[model samples]
Target: MTEFGYFLSSEEHGPQALIEQARMAEQAGFTSLWISDHFHPWTAEQGQSPFVWSVIGALSEAVSLPVQTAVTCPTRRIHPVVTAQAAATSSVMLDGRFRLGVGSGEALNESVLGDEWPEAAVRLEMLEEAVQIMRRLFRGEQVSHRGRHFTVQNARLYTLPGEPVPIDVSAFGPQAAEIAGRIGDGFITMAPVPEAIERFRRSGGGTKPVAAGLKVCWALDRDEAVQTAHRLWASEQLPGELSQILPTPRHIEQANELVTPERVAEHITCGSDADAHAAALREYVDAGFDTVYVNQIGPDQQGFFDFYRTKVLPQLNGA
Candidate 1:
């Protein structure tokens, strides 16, 4: 059965507001939670980047739903060993209901450290190395890796869960998906394309968990929802990693110039009609995702939840 989840937008909501929303999402019967792990918002308009790990800790005390980083880059901004330790600690804190979802990463967030942003192939190579490092560290073994991109000297994690933390690699392109199949316990994506899913399986992944997410604006008014969603998350409509490695918000805004509301709406469901929202999400399930996460864009978040809870989730859940 495909399960429904929600994304906690660290970019739009404050910690208290998001915690309350998470509690409400639990009450409304969401099965899982995925939060953004962005260091910077694509634009100042979206505003807010609370450290996701701290929010996860609070969520551990506030709710029972399992959580995952919609995707975190363990390659550059944070070392894989550190990420492994964090995931281990989070797993224990969440009582073994946490999964680590990682990817090649973007420069917008990583380059902030003053590291030269590498191209796609190099980024993927770094991701491969990072995954090896993370797995070794998760095993609670001493690691002294000297890779081309990263090096760690005799580092051993002191605290880890008794079991290895499950890794879900986030992949969009075919190469990345193949790598995920070769290495990851599961796969995380956004496009939810059947071909990609097939590639993942063909490469070595089986019927393990497959997760994808899409942005939405839900309201009684269609135009308002589209406008709000576009205004807030237009950057997502832009192709590639503006949030992870891009130079500036202006670069994002420039790339997003191609992301018209029409273009975004074609891929994502925006506007007020409950059935439309449900159908939009259904497309992802049809594409082979075992789990679908929905992120509400703009400020009408409570309304987004209410609409999905009362109108959308039931239909998707087979009510």
Candidate 2:
């Protein structure tokens, strides 16, 4: 079954607001949740970036649905030992219903600590090493690793989950997908590219769950929704490696100038047409994703939820 999930936008909502949204998602029939882990929002217009671990703790208390970090970068901004501890604590709090979704990461968030960002190949290598260290820590073993990219001295987590947290790797390219398959418990991507999924399966992913997240704007007026999506997420449309290499929101905003409203409208599912939204989600389902998470853009959160609850989800789920 292709489960429907809601993507909590940590970049757009405060911690309390995110908790409330999680509750609403559960009530509205979403099967799971995906929250982003970011040190910084992509652009200033999006506004909020709470500590994801704190938000996850509150979510454990607020919703029974499973949760996963849409993706967290364990390589640079935080050590894998600390990330492991945080993830283990989160999994215990959620009653072993949490997943640690990881990636090589982007400079917009990872570069904040003034560390020079490594290139893609190095970043992926560091990520592989970090995952090994984290898996050891999750087993309540004291880990002392002195690797090429990191060092951990006799670090152990006392508070642990009943089971080791599953780490899902996010990849958009073949190289990252290969790494994800070779090392990840599962695979994640933004688009519904069957070839990438096939590559992952061949590389080593096998039958592990595959998940993807997509954004939609559910405004009553199509043009209004398009403008909101364009203003808030234009940076997402930047070409090539710009998203991974950009150092700050300001630089990202400057780069966002290249994305036009027409492009956003063409690419994003906007407006109140239920069929359109259903069709958009169907594309991912058709691509063989086990789970698809949808994020509603702009301030019409309640409206989007209501629309999905009444019109879209029923159609998708065949309820």
- What's each prediction's TM-score? 0.95, 0.99
lDDT digits (tens) for residues 165-216 of candidate 2:
9999999999999999999999999998999999999999999999999999
Best by TM-score: 2
Top model by lDDT, which number?
A: 2
CA lDDT of every candidate: 0.84, 0.94
- Which segments of model 1 are wrong by more than 4 Å? 240-245
Worst 10 residues of 2 by lDDT: 310-319
RMSD of 2: 0.9
Estimate the TM-score for candidate 2: 0.99
lDDT of 2 at 267: 91
Q: What is the lDDT of residue 43 in candidate 1?
A: 74
The residue-level lDDT of candidate 2 at 47 comes to 99
Q: Model 1: which residue pairs collide?
A: 106-244, 106-245, 107-244, 107-245, 108-244, 108-245, 108-246, 109-244
Candidate 1 residue-wise lDDT, 1-319, digit = tens = 7888888888788788889989888877788999988787777787888888999999999999999997888887898878888898999999889999998877767777888889888988998899899899888889998989889999998878778899999998889999999998999998768999999998899887789988887777877777777777877766555555567666776777778987766766777788788888888988988888888887777787787778889898752
TM-score of 1: 0.95
